[model samples]
Target: MIDLTSIYHRAADNYCYLFDEETLHIRIRTKRDNVLEIVLLYGDQYEIVDHQWITSLQPLEKIGSDSLFDYWQVAIKAEHKRIRYGFILKNTEQEMTLTEKGFFSFIPEDSGFFFCFPYMHKSDVFSSPDWVQQTIWYQIFPERFRNGDPLLNPAHTVEWGQEEPSLTNFFGGDFQGIIDSLDYLQDLGINGIYLTPIFLANSNHKYDTIDYFTIDPQFGNINLLKKLVEECHNRGIRVMLDAVFNHCSVEFLPFQDVLDKGEKSLYKDWFHIHKFPLKDGDTINYETFGFYEYMPKLNTANEEVKQYLLKAAAYWIAECQIDGWRLDVANEIDHQFWRDFRTTVKAIKPDLFILGEVWHDSVSWLRGDQFDSVMNYPFLHKSLQFFSYDIISAHQFTEDLTTILHSYSDNINQVLFNILGSHDTPRVLNECRFRKERVRLLFTFLFTFPGTPCIYYGDEIGLDGGNDPGCRKCMPWQEEQQDLELKDYIKTLISIRKETSLLTSKGTLYFLPAVNNCLAYYKQKDNQVVFVLINNSDTEIDYVLPFSLSGKKINLLLTQQEYAAESDELSVTLAPYESNILSFYI
Candidate 1:
């Protein structure tokens, strides 16, 4: 047997957590080459008599393996809110028991051999808003959504859809415009709206914040915002506003004071000024977000700055009753600030959703102390690489996705904000090179995947753009200018997601093995199973179902095709660039 002294740990990730007072998630890790399987021997900590402990042996699934170790996981309920657990490791030829003390040939009678979870408390449980699981979010770039009140349009504002978007351009989109298009969003089946920075800022994008307390004049006044929030809530839609606390626009009053009175400014500590005198040009002495001169990084470490930003976050929820805050540049800020931010926000509104804009692995921020969820950019990248770019084969795609699912706890993965295209990336249709079939397959995977899927504004109607400025095109109100077919397809996908409980956020995902360029997976919840198949290759292929479907009724969700399994094996032919979602009721 492999050496048991190579490593030792209880649970490295946030895998050990109390979902509630009784349910506990526990996980352990061992050397990748050491153990073939592990069995968790656990029971109530006090269930012992006459030098023997009563315990239950439960097998641990090998969730994932990295270069050094293999991660095994399990979730159990401690009826008494206390647990004593130990691990039994096995190889092909040998078996050994592992405990808090060390490895042994047999289970030890002493209680010290087991690791103890004294008690599971309700207060320590990590949870997000209940409404998040059923939500289908629609992200709106406010300036590009609509133009309801042209009177409030900026002096330099151009015609709504006539002008191409530039770095600095406005089309007079406002809250009233959003209010006017409530029916459109509601009919499209969106239950949540994530609006990018609507606070007062000089730029049309509004990330460069000039004021946080007041709404942008171009967007509307506080009354208009209240009305917007009320309308959205009335329609059962939750509104999440963007919070850019990492930095502020150079035009901000505090930054202006620092620029005018270099050393004498009382607000000098508010920002990170490298030198006494601040000069402009290519050379930047102080820290900024990606070296941009106009957007100076805020000194979030300071207590004063923390209080100021916390107040701004509290102001929106307390005054307008906004549902949540989507933090901008969330990773650059300190963790303590976010922990405090969560405390401040959750105290006022307990169920408020907090989403962080993190592009990479965000396990650190999602430990239940900081943000509720983060933007799933890793999923998007891997998806595009497999479906749109065809850089990876079907097997590699599944392997990469499995690694992602195993990286986080089950609870964190359920509420993850999954996105295909956003304000930051190229439009999904553009990424697919305007192929409608590829777009369909992409959305099919997105809606069926286990998370809350987000739709960027105008993507439903076949809006195509390269990147940032190009992706921020004005919403087309006219029926002739829109792709009605694609819009209807997306509407149907949302309807399926809402109507089907298993497809929404909680479903067991299984990646079926495929031989060629075709990909398939099964999403099973209870007795219902949804089998999704996508043909990425150019040639038609006859694919066989991976599992036995004998005596079960099969109905394809998208095409409405029906079939009966005569034998244990069932085969179907998939056209090039085609997709199918088969539902089997057993």
Candidate 2:
């Protein structure tokens, strides 16, 4: 047995290692160590593979102080399978064991290493496409968005002892509804639309999926969806449908059949069943998620079920021409399924983006598998939690924002959807007591900060609601009662975001300063440099510009307001929740 207890060391400067059955690639951290060669050994006989050097590390940083090195990566094919493997330094004639780690770490057979790191084994189970990195998505709850076609509305009364509902209960929003509003979306500069699950489901919110293949009758049939996709494609917009693979409704055909006939049912193997409730037919004794009772969890471990889901996903991409998917409760489902699903989906279309619904750190999902990005709830949650005390100081906000940025992985940090509030939470304007100035600043940060920004529907018109059902209210089309100032402010911001290359194009973010209840940050890409400053203090505060960033600080937006930068200090007075954009050449 390979000794699992030993902490084998690579060279002190070696930072990266990639090994499959055949080859082992090692990367040196510093440029000085780039000349070293690697040797793999087994049973006193050694196999040597020459190192092919890639470019040196772009920016050099001291690691501890022992060694200096550079990167060396090579692809190799091994002669025989070796259990006990170690590497030797070519120049120094020194050897030490290299234990496996990371997403591809191999497990020792006897020690139950697989059980200990079950999730890690499940980490590389999927491969998401690269386009998800560039998507600026907008999530819309169909019931609340708009009502286009009235004919597709389900009858108020159902047949054979079915529950009946009024038209108000079902707002009659359909596929055509979204189709009619493409111009509005295009004008707003949204690239993608992430509609909630439109599958055949019972609830107004389609979390309870009844059929995997069919579109909900209330939301029009499959044909309508295809048409909608075509129209959206014509307008240069991509559509991403929500996939609730975690659970199915009790009324779902499979679940209902299982409930009707205990073990004898054909779909018995699909769910995790032990016993059913005696009073209300047979209730399956299966493990379910924490959300609600009606939503029964699917057995993704079953290969047949896995294939069916993959087929359905492929059907949407191939048949409906969807550009991506927003996976619901992705963490709760089987890891292998995600891996297989990603592979299968990518095989169908390499550009299909998969966004997972992970509320916390979703690094494992975003690492070139399963998902390209997550909902970014961590950013919104922390930001809102800090500002819930009725006021957010600029320094506190900046610190909190920077902490979130650094915590995330490089891929997710840049592509994350920075949303103020979604259908799941209270509206920001309502929570901030209808303070339009603060709302304006928050939206400004959302559009300017790292990652793709999303705007919750009706937020631009100052819609206020506290929680779910209320927060997910219908679109207020009453033009006379709208917040014109807030709407105009949002329009201005949106226009600027679409027109300005610095705001739209991604760049390296650098923190400038956070002093006297004011914060400053800069984004640089190519020749464009945009400096964002936010003042959260009650009284007017003067900002002293950094000496290094002096000369030609032109006010990009507020041109009427005069500011001066001379002799190392740029003094400008800022009102409460006032923000400014200072454009200059680097």
The Cα error of candidate 1 at residue 79, in Å, is 2.8
Winner by TM-score: 1
Per-residue lDDT of 150-255 in model 1, one digit per residue for the tens? 9999998999988889898889999999999999999999999999999889998999999888889898899999999999999999999999999999999999
Clashes by residue pair, model 2: 22-78, 30-69, 30-70, 31-69, 33-69, 125-339, 126-339, 276-283, 277-283, 545-570
Q: Candidate 1, which segments miss by more than 4 Å at Cα?
A: 1-9, 12-14, 28-36, 62-71, 100-109, 280-282, 505-507, 562-564
**Residue pairs with clashing backbones, model 1:** none
lDDT of 1 at 282: 60
**Per-residue lDDT value at 275 in model 2:** 66
State how far residue 571 of model 2 sits from its true place (Å). 3.0
Candidate 2 has its poorest 10 consecutive residues by lDDT at: 111-120
Q: List candidate 2 segments past 4 Å from native.
A: 1-135, 156-168, 277-284, 387-393, 504-507, 547-555, 558-568
